[model samples]
Target: MNSPDSAAATATAFDKARTGLWVSLQKHLTTVYEAETAFAQAIAFAEAFPFAASSASPEQLDLYWQRRRALRDLFTDETNQLDTLNKAIRTKGYADAEKKQLYLLLLGYMDIAASIFERLHTEVPKPLPKDDELEETSARFERVRKFARLNVKGIFGLLATAAQ
Candidate 1:
């Protein structure tokens, strides 16, 4: 019963949705790369000197804290962007195919983020150990990972139903 123009419009919508998803995915990947770099820097710092040693300098402590703060902020910004992108996708009417594709892209990024968090948490450097600091970092990483995973999964599920 669908008219030709309606079918064409639907195809256009799908294209738009795919493009938007691609852009968002690229941004998310960039964020992931930044976070990975920061993690590597942290590990390097931890390995270069003993954080737990009594002789650890105040400057060294500050530098380490600064790197962690910067990385955390980057991830937070990325998460906020993803939230915004999701909202946009929901509000903008698009073909079912497009919506499903977008949802899948988001889900994939969430999975990647979760994987990165798990790896970081499990493979943390053993030297220069500060239990409290490590715990805090791990907690923050898990928090973001959980939020992204839950939201993406929910949206993907909704899109799946819509597509059907």
Candidate 2:
């Protein structure tokens, strides 16, 4: 159904894109973890100082906000790239519908990650959660990252199959 040359080219391009996405995602995750950690530390500081119990110290908030902004910017770049890639795939008619399904699955993973990052980066009028709650949020994020890793591997496998 598809030419070998076309498939090879698609595989190469997909590999390159996936690698970039992987690196960016890793950095994004690290940034998110750092932000959460900073917030948690702030919460701890607040608890120790009853006067600041209502909120974290200004320095801590600033650090968290900085990391959150970084995360938001990184995620925006990645999603933009993905949207472009999706459009390219459609234009090129890469492989078949089956291959497209793999891409869609990868998109789903991104959507879930977006939901997590959105909450972190949004300007909601809500106080940061307690340390214990923040740990749970971190756990959820880690789980999503792990699942995304698996999804990425699966997509690579699909590409391999298509290449052959």
Scored by lDDT, the top model is: 1
Q: For each candidate, C-alpha RMSD in Å?
A: 6.5, 9.8
Give the poorly placed runs of model 2, Cα more than 4 Å off.
Answer: 1-54, 121-164
Per-residue lDDT of candidate 1, residues 1-164 (tens digit): 98999989878877877886788688778877777776666555454332353333666556555665566565556566666766676666764455556767776786676566454345433352455654565565556445544454567776887799
Best by TM-score: 1
Candidate 1 global TM-score = 0.61
How many clashes would you count in candidate 2?
0
lDDT of 2 by residue, 32-110 (tens): 5665455444344433322332365577667655655565455555455555545554465445543445455555556
lDDT score, candidate 2: 0.53
The collision pairs in model 1 are: none
Model 1 worst lDDT run, 10 consecutive residues? 47-56
Cα error, candidate 2, residue 117 (Å): 1.7
Q: What is the lDDT of residue 112 in candidate 2?
A: 56
Assess the local accuracy of residue 48 in candidate 2 as a C-alpha lDDT between 0 and 100: 35
Q: What is the Å distance of residue 32 in model 1 from its true position?
A: 2.7
